[model samples]
Target: MARNILPLHKRDKTDTPSTRNASTIVPSEQAPSPSHEPKHHHQPHRPRHENALHSYVNNFWRNEIVAAAAEFAGTFMFLFFAFGGTQVANTAALFSDRATAGQENSGLTQAPNTSVLLYISLIFGFSLMVNVWVFFRVSGGLFNPAVTLGLLLIGAIKPIRACFCFFSQMFAGMAAAGIVSAILPGPLNVSTNLGTGVTPTMGVFLEMFLTSLLVFTIFMLAAEKHKATFLAPIGIGLALFVAEMVGVFFTGGSLNPARSFGPCVVTRNFPGYHYVYWFGPLMGTLLAFGMYRIVKIVEYQTVNPGQDFDDHEAAAFKPPKDAETAEQVGRPNVAALAVEEAVEEAVRIVSRGSREERDEEERIDGRLERGEQPRYVSERELLGRTGHGRV
Candidate 1:
């Protein structure tokens, strides 16, 4: 080792970039001190492509265009399944050999017509359930324009976004109807007024009443936070199923305007009062709004009995058990408790003083009635006369 040692001046410099640059650098007139050396900030290890992709994704998702596109896609998927089911049922019934009408067979009148209704109901309900489950997080599962309107009226969705949702739903309905019409036979493509038999006026009322109940159910079970929120889709589907069962004959149970709109447009057969579908659902939304308000009021009263009835404050009320547990875990509302304590103390002080004054006045009145001289003495005088203030 001693034989191999070399002087620092004769040693070869490393060929690294920094060493080469240092060697080639022209010496400055004045060299900066070590303290003045530039501190290099090292960025954390990250792929450039990853950062680019992340920014693109973040901006894309937040864009309104993407939201509207999502709405369109969800609505299209929903209507495709809903109307496709309808056409399938209708086609099957048309080709069936069994007597759809109530006819006397085997010495008994056998009506297979009810089977069609049942089939349609189940299909529609299933379609709704699946679509809602699939698209709930992205588009709020609003496959119906009326539902979008309801959300708008309830302040759940903004007006512009609601408009986009409405347009998407209607367009999807129309597209689904057209596709169904094209795929099925000519005779099968013809719409059946959604199977409604009632007059226009009766149909409007039926739709309004039924849709009101449906929207009411949605508001109560799905929109509000509760145990049933997880089962909202099922509850909504059942509500529609029940409404269909009740109003299927009277108004075709077309609670959704989009459901009716598609068939009407494809067939070009506007049942005399085409506006009924729109008017009915919108009116039903208003009724639902009223019902939701009443429900919120009742819920508020039930949850917070002693609190003021304020709509904005209703949401803050928790379940009984949760509230009690929260009260135990956290400090109570100190300001309100302090105010109550002050009020109670004031009342107690005033009452005690008033009672003592009444007793002294009563004693004086009794003495006067007995023909004895009554005296109203100051505290200092009484203390001096009694020698001790206790008496």
Candidate 2:
């Protein structure tokens, strides 16, 4: 295959669309030699309706199902750990009271102590970090309904899908919290009984401000692919930790409305906290979206022009130029290649390895039979296989 390389020039910050387009492509026509014929690349064509349907199905899974699942799982895990930690905090305090009474009067705060605050904060932080890590590849770690709504406002997510994801996160959070509450040994009174954290209106506004700051931090960290990628969760977690420290005494620092509303619904304690839960987080999210737009403008000017937007948009908007050529192309199909590689691996294992290896191979094959893709190994492992070694 003959490759055509296009050299890209940096456009001025103030360049108009036409001026940018002028600098974008510099076409050069090369005369063909007697030995080398000019190769014309014809775009692949298909029936418009068939093509549209194929494209829609492919994109539906990529943009909807995969995206929604990531949001759902992230939200579920976050609520599970957060509310679970809250319950644990309450239970531990109950036990601590009994222990401290037996001994001489030691000056410790009563049930729902400082330790509870720290533990709950840590759980919320850790769960968020894990969810971000898991879903960053898919939905960009948008675990919050408010954040999703903000993205919709900025044209990041489609309006219809945004509504679906927001509701999904809320429902998932509530269900997960309810399940956690049920499994734990306690008075199963579903009427303002359990620890459903709520606070005053002032506290709600404060939480909105703090959550806005936190969401802004997430936008900034995710916008760039630097050390901030790894630090995003830490930054978010620490922000939550600090917020909790300041606001736990007032309203449990429920920066996440789903986190607050979930427990409240499960425990059946509608202490008018729902108003703040909806309005505060949504307000903060919108504020954060504004901050991101400003920051993006500055960042865009500073960063060198690259393939990020161009490549992404091309994949989304354009069809392959040659359908027949694409089908005939012999390059490895990543999905198919993975399955073949896994099968070969299993054969090698069963042929020469231990019982454990055979059992593992069977398990892997079962997953494959059940339509699961091969497990994605780390970049280091991939590099090693390619003989380029690690970074």
Candidate 3:
């Protein structure tokens, strides 16, 4: 320190020229460059390329969530017309009621109007058809929980997505019923009930058969994924139409638990046999799935496939293209994929092999390279015994 402050002439003997060299900074001890200095500017809390909020939203609204939203909206619209028409049917039935004037002016009961029942059938069928046609591309227009389960069983939809759709359908069913009750003026009769003389046992089996018919149509039309897939809604709607026509009279024709659930929620009524709606539909889903599998095993399309229009992949009745890869258009073959991978691995192995391996690849003329020769050329030798004059 004294050497730095002192005049050269006044410096101590220890601070001489050679010793003073130690007082100055060496290159190794120099201060850090400007870049190495601590930065004072604030850095971003999130990455620049991806926004945290956007990533969160994308994950929150995944495919399952989007499908669930579509299910909720579609189911709501489906049941809105359904419940509204049911109320109208009940009201219309009142006008259709005919009372016979008894001799002593006695109170009389009237049977339900058959015409009103048909009207209910049309309302449910047309509502399903229109909404399914509108929303099938988005979320499969599966307003019914049983249909969703059918798709899940057949491997058309994932488990998470099925769960999301189930909850969405249930909530939408209740909402539709609530709205109908609030606006319409009539006691709700949409809830399922066993008809007069109809036992609980009969109701369950009947409900199962009706629901099975609906699910079977869905599997063959939609899940099978054929040229007629676009027209699946028509068949599905009609299946519900007939099922409802029959079951509506006996079991309220509740082919769907959601259909049964909504009215119960609105009217605040649960029949002691409410279990029929859920259990019957579930059993029906299983039955339809089993039948579809049986047909699949037997290759029914090959046996009695009706018209062999052999339609094109997209449009029903359109002829298929004359291409070898036509059959593989939508179907993924694992064996084909394995062969592709095997070819790639062979190419990679050859690419890294010795020069000899490269020459061994398939050739057009079936000829060896110029300088290469067969390890043993028997015929070309001409039995040298004769050539040596030993014959």
- In candidate 1, what are the lDDT values of residues 305-368, reduced to their tens digit? 4243245334433336534332332323446766897999999999999898667656755665
Model 1's alpha-carbon lDDT is 0.65
Instruction: Give one digit per residue, the lDDT tens place, for model 3 in 36-107.
Output: 655554444984685455655676456677899999999999999987887677666654553421111111
Model 2 TM = 0.55
Q: Estimate each model's TM-score.
A: 0.61, 0.55, 0.63
How far does residue 311 in candidate 2 sit from its true spot (Å)? 27
Ranking by lDDT: 3, 1, 2
Q: For candidate 1, report its TM-score.
A: 0.61
- Give one digit per residue, the lDDT tens place, for model 2 in 65-154: 767777888788777776666666656665667553211111111234667667766776777777777777877777787777766777
Off by over 4 Å in 2: 1-58, 98-112, 187-199, 224-227, 296-391
Better of 2 and 3 by TM-score: 3
Which sections of candidate 1 miss by over 4 Å?
1-63, 97-112, 186-197, 300-391
Residue 385 error, candidate 2, Å: 50
Per-candidate Cα lDDT values, in order, are 0.65, 0.62, 0.74
